[model samples]
Target: MVKKILIVCIGNICRSPTAENLMRDALNHADIEVASAGLAALVDSPIEPTAQAVLEEQGHLPSAHKAVQLTSQTVNRADLILVMEKRHVTGVLGIAPEARGKVFLLGKWQEDREISDPYRQGKPAFVHAYALIEEAVHAWAQRLVG
Candidate 1:
């Protein structure tokens, strides 16, 4: 059973944090742990407001998620790693080559799509990203804990 999941993106303040929370809520299994990180994080910043608003719209209030940087330790701790894009795979593996088998695109089961970041683009971009993230997270939840 996968005990720990890590979501990764460019900045921890947007897509990844959103994915992390959504996955956690979707799974809602006590034994699982969900977290997120950025290859190049904003470091201690809060989640983007647009992203937060979209999450609330979906009935899941955003948590106090502070940006965390991706490190070898965090990568190693993850039983599974879900990244937002293809290039992110390179970044995670560069941190820990042994993670290759465990790292996967979050949208791998959703036709291998990429979840784009919608930082300052306002509500529409955030909603679009949230839809993709919600689908991917739900797909993963079914696979991981169903």
Candidate 2:
């Protein structure tokens, strides 16, 4: 069984954090850990407001999450690293090539999809992005845990 999961994106304030929370909620009963990080994170910044609002609307709380950077240490710790886009895979591999096999697109197990970033767009865009992340995370939880 996969004990640890790391979700990755660009800012860590949007997509990855949502994915991480969704996965955590779905796998609440499972003996696994879930976290999130960014390739170009804001270091200790809080999650974006738009992202937080969308999550709250969906009954998921994301107000306490702070952005974290992706590092070799985090990469090494995760049993599975689920990225938002294809470039993230390359970027993570560049940081830790040994993590190659464990890294995968969060949406890959579903429809070979890519979850687009909604960084500075607005509330609507963030909502759309959250929907995508929610689907991907739920699918992952089912496949990996259920």
Candidate 3:
């Protein structure tokens, strides 16, 4: 059974962190750990303001998450690494070649889409991305819990 889930995106402040926090809230179990990292991390940066606002609106926990770089160690610790886009899969594999079997798109089951980056984009963009992350996380939770 899966225990650790690592979510990935471009910067960790926008998409991945949203997925991480939402998943943590949804799963709400101590045995399962949810975390996030970035391909080109903003390192030490907190979750984007608009992203945090969107999460707050949804009644999810507002995380004070610092951006972390994706590393080989992080890759190994994760039982499942769900990335926001296809390119992220390539970057993670480069860090830990053996992570192949465990990595997947966050939106893989739902049309295999990419959750867009909403860094400089306005609240609307963040809102839309948050919705996508929520949907994707719920889909994953159902699958993983089974």
Candidate 4:
């Protein structure tokens, strides 16, 4: 029954945006709207180049993402908010205390694993993160659709 989903990470230019686009592609549920934001956003920054390249290599079209800061209003709008790390969940709660029930780790089903930041770590790091995100996205998609 989740009508809207928000993916979150620290910067929005890496993990969150990657997960956002992948989830959008995987879900295919017309009623579910997916978006992303950063706890401490870069504000107007695009997806990190290495991250974008990893996504493209995996056949996921990178969206025209502009980094956005997470706000209470954004949290309220999402029925579900998937974050990249445990700290991000805490950060989101700090923004919207009432969002406690809606927030979760993107890797919730994958042993609660956290997707690490790959900002300046180059393509290898981005590739590793991409695999994790893709796996998590599929897990979520199955649960969401089933």
- Best candidate, lDDT-wise? 4
Residue 15 lDDT (model 4): 92
Ranking by lDDT: 4, 1, 3, 2
Off by over 4 Å in 3: none
TM-score of each: 0.97, 0.96, 0.96, 0.97
Quote the lDDT for 129 in model 1.
Answer: 94
Query: Model 4, poorest ten-residue lDDT window?
Result: 23-32
Worst 10 residues of 1 by lDDT: 22-31
Candidate 4 segments whose C-alpha is farther than 4 A from its true place: none
How many backbone overlaps does candidate 1 show?
Answer: 0
Clashes of each: 0, 0, 0, 0
lDDT of 3 by residue, 1-146 (tens): 88999999988889998999999988885479999999899999999888988888888877689999999999999999999989999999999999999999999888998988988989889989988888998899989875
Question: What pairs collide in candidate 4?
Answer: none
Candidate 2 accuracy as lDDT: 0.89
Worst 10 residues of 3 by lDDT: 22-31
lDDT of 2 by residue, 1-146 (tens): 69999999998988988888889999999999999999999989888888887888889876488889899999999999999899999999999999989999998966779989898887888888887888888888888877
Shift of residue 5 alpha carbon in model 1, Å: 0.2
- 2 versus 4: better TM-score goes to: 4
Model 4, 1-146: lDDT tens per residue? 89999999998999999999999998775669999999999999999988888899888888899999999999999999999899998999999999999999999999999989988988899999999999999999988987
lDDT of 1 by residue, 35-125 (tens): 9999999999999888888888889977799999999999999999999999999999999999989999999998989988788888889
Better of 2 and 4 by lDDT: 4
Q: Compute the lDDT of residue 60 as modeled in candidate 4.
A: 82
